[model samples]
Target: MTNLWSPITLGGITLPHRLAMAPMTRSRAKPDGTPGDLAPEYYAQRASLGLLISEGTQPSEDGQGYLATPGIYTDAHVAGWRKVADAVHAADGRLFIQLMHVGRRSHPDNTPHHRQPVAPSAIASGDSMFTMSGMQPVPQPRALETEEVQQTIADLAYAAKRAIDAGADGVEIHGANGYLVHQFLAPDSNHRTDEYGGTMKNRARFAIDVVRAVVDAIGPQKTAIRLSPGVATGGIAEGQDNDDLYRYLAVELGTLGLAYLHILYARNDPLLEDVRRSFGGPLVLNRPGRSRQQIGADVSAGLADIEALGVMALANPDLVQRLKTGAPLNDVRSALFYAGGGAEGYTDYPAIGIV
Candidate 1:
């Protein structure tokens, strides 16, 4: 059986291991959307992972969702990210920026422009989000005009270029997590009657266009996408037809020859196999809520080419060494996952044989 330390090639980049550090929102950026000093240190500490997918970063001003979340479109954002990319590269670790456009999942207070959130339709998420003023109901968003949708795709392409200029290994479009792309994919959020709405093909058009634009900006080998099938987290409510939508979306995206497709699987649904067949490149699977004992089994069983980890990578900087040596794993504190600051569940975790 291949162990977790086995090497895997993700597109043109060759990873030293099959373990990828999944993107987790840290909410630690500067107020201006620039990644702070702590950001580089945090990512550099966990550079042992085969690949590090940075936290969800907004691709444009209106894309900002949570307060202090990072951005990649501005010059300041690029400079901030350059430091982070250099730090990770110095450690010989590969990094990819996850481009996230929150769509209706945004708050005016969280963004600098204080602009109303926009989506495929004017409907509200019926959910609340965390802001500087604490939890509040998500306000109704304005619907994007047909022409504005094209500009949004252009914004993503520009951001991908900026990320590459900032020294990232690649860019991963955040098409999941109930963000802008997911909102279009889910029938509940997308209520438009234009070319971007209605049937599965139309609904998937916006996401495909964004992907194509990003791929065109920085070749397909440097582009990737993250998708969640049938899991309705973060106020996203897609009906049973999610399987069909993903099957068609995946096949369409596969034609572009993207670097990889990262799927956050909810269950052992038969569609998982369909997605694997639909995507014609490297596949990275994140088995949410899986225990440590089940890690190696999933890969050995041919379920995924690479395994993505979240809290484990958060708590254990040397997770690869610990797992390979059969050492005890660090216990993660859920409370401090987004509390921000240093050494309090961020870098306090000890390395293998240290404790």
Candidate 2:
């Protein structure tokens, strides 16, 4: 049985454990999208995890979805990320920066330019987003022109390069959770008739192009992608051919020889078995409702190479120790998660023995 404590290799880098720190948005970046000084300490505190994937960071101005989310396209952003990378590396940790483009899941007030959101089509997500003025409705986004689709892919590649230049071990393209790449994947959200849409292969083209571009910019060994086939977050209702869409995507992306594929899994998701068979590289499984005792169940069952934890890692800096020792986990104060407090619930989470 592959236990959570056992070592594993991903992208040629060996991890001491199978527990990976999943990315969670803390909204701690500055108004300018540069990560704050506290960000390094926050991540370094949980460096014991096999892999630490940073919060979703915008790859371009139009990619910004929420206020205070970080960006990876500028010098300031690179400098800020370098501190985080150095800190995590000092503790012998590996880090991957998650490149996220929120697509139409944005309000004008939330962006630095106050620009309208863009997506595969001009449809609104019928959702509201948190802005400086509180929550507001997400307006219908302008559809990206055929030529602009390539530009968006270029932006993602540039951001991946910037992350690597900033000292990150690699970058994970966020294709899940109704983001830009995902918006293009789901038929309901992407109603385009161009080369980038309509057919399942066309819908998967943008994501594959973006991945190939990122792999070119930063070697395939340092590239990865996260996919959520069954998720409908941000009001995205997938079409009837959702299974076929992902099956095509998984097999296509799996052929790229990338580092690993991280999946957000749910109970009895049939696509799990398909994706497992199609994708030949390392697979990291993230079960939404998994308890500590079941951390390594997927790995023990040979279904996953690593177990990725979100809330457990957020609330417990020493999550590995707590899971191993069967110690109580600190309760997560969800309110403080995105409250912008530098040290409140961010870095103040104590390990097992603190008083």
Candidate 3:
């Protein structure tokens, strides 16, 4: 039976286990979009997880949604990430930098350019986000002109190439969580009549294009993407057609021979199996709030090839060994989840013994 500890090969890398560290935003990057200095140590500590997907790093300045999130398209960003990649690799961990474009889920005050956000449509998510001043309401975004949409896809490709230059094992496109790709997928968020909107196939065009571009920039083995089907985060409403949309999407993505497809889900449903069958590749499933007992359930059941952990891996740097020996986990300090005083709650969590 395939379990969490089962050896698996993904993207040409043989991992000792199936447990991977999910990308969680820590907002710890520098103001210029470079990763913080402690990023190397933070990731190196979790090297036992084998596959560490870095926190959502933006593809461009306009791609940033949260404060201090890293970017992958610049020299400073590349150098900063190189340090992180070297650290993780030295400890036998493979790194995949997640390229995320936040779309309309951003605030002007938080962006490098203090301008309105952009998306498939000019619609606003009507969500609020944290900024330097305080939490502010998300404003309406300008719709991307057809030309700009093409440019955005090109930008993603460029970022993927840059990720390789930084010595990352691969790049995972953040197509989930009501971001730019998700905005194009949802009809409500995308009102375009062009080749990128309207029908489900059309809405899927942007995502498919982005993936193809990234795959072209980097080889298919060095490229992956994360998707959330039923998630309503960032005011994304997939509506009733959600099931059909994803079936079509999975089948389409499966054709590209991607390294793996990461699915972020809240509950298990037939849709999960549908996607697994249609995707037909290594699937990494991240079920938020999954308990310790349920660690290998999906993998054992053949529903997923790998399992992703967020808070559990965050608190336990030696998560694999701790579980292997049955050790207690540290409680999460929710208040300091984001960028805060240096490494208090970020990397101060003890491995197992030393105090």
The candidate with the higher TM-score, 1 or 2, is 2
Clashing pairs in model 1? none
lDDT of 3 by residue, 245-331 (tens): 888989999999999999998474689999999999999999998999999998988889999999999888999988999988888
Task: Put down candidate 1 lDDT per residue, 209-312, tens digits, no spaces.
Answer: 99999999999999999999787866776656667999999899999999899999878457888888888788889887878888777678777888999999
Task: Supply the TM-score for candidate 3.
Answer: 0.98
1 versus 3: better lDDT goes to = 3
* Deviating ranges (above 4 Å) for candidate 1: 1-3
Q: Candidate order by TM-score, highest to lowest?
A: 3, 2, 1
Weakest 10 consecutive residues of candidate 1 by summed lDDT: 233-242
Ranking 1 against 3 by TM-score, winner = 3
lDDT accuracy of residue 48 in candidate 1: 87
List per-candidate RMSD values in Å: 1.3, 1.1, 0.9
Which residue ranges in model 2 land beyond 4 Å of their true spot? Answer: none
Per candidate, the number of residue pairs that clash is 0, 0, 0
- In candidate 2, list every pair of residues with a backbone clash: none
Candidate 2 lDDT over 112-174, as tens digits, reads 888889999999999988877788889999999998899999999999999999999999999
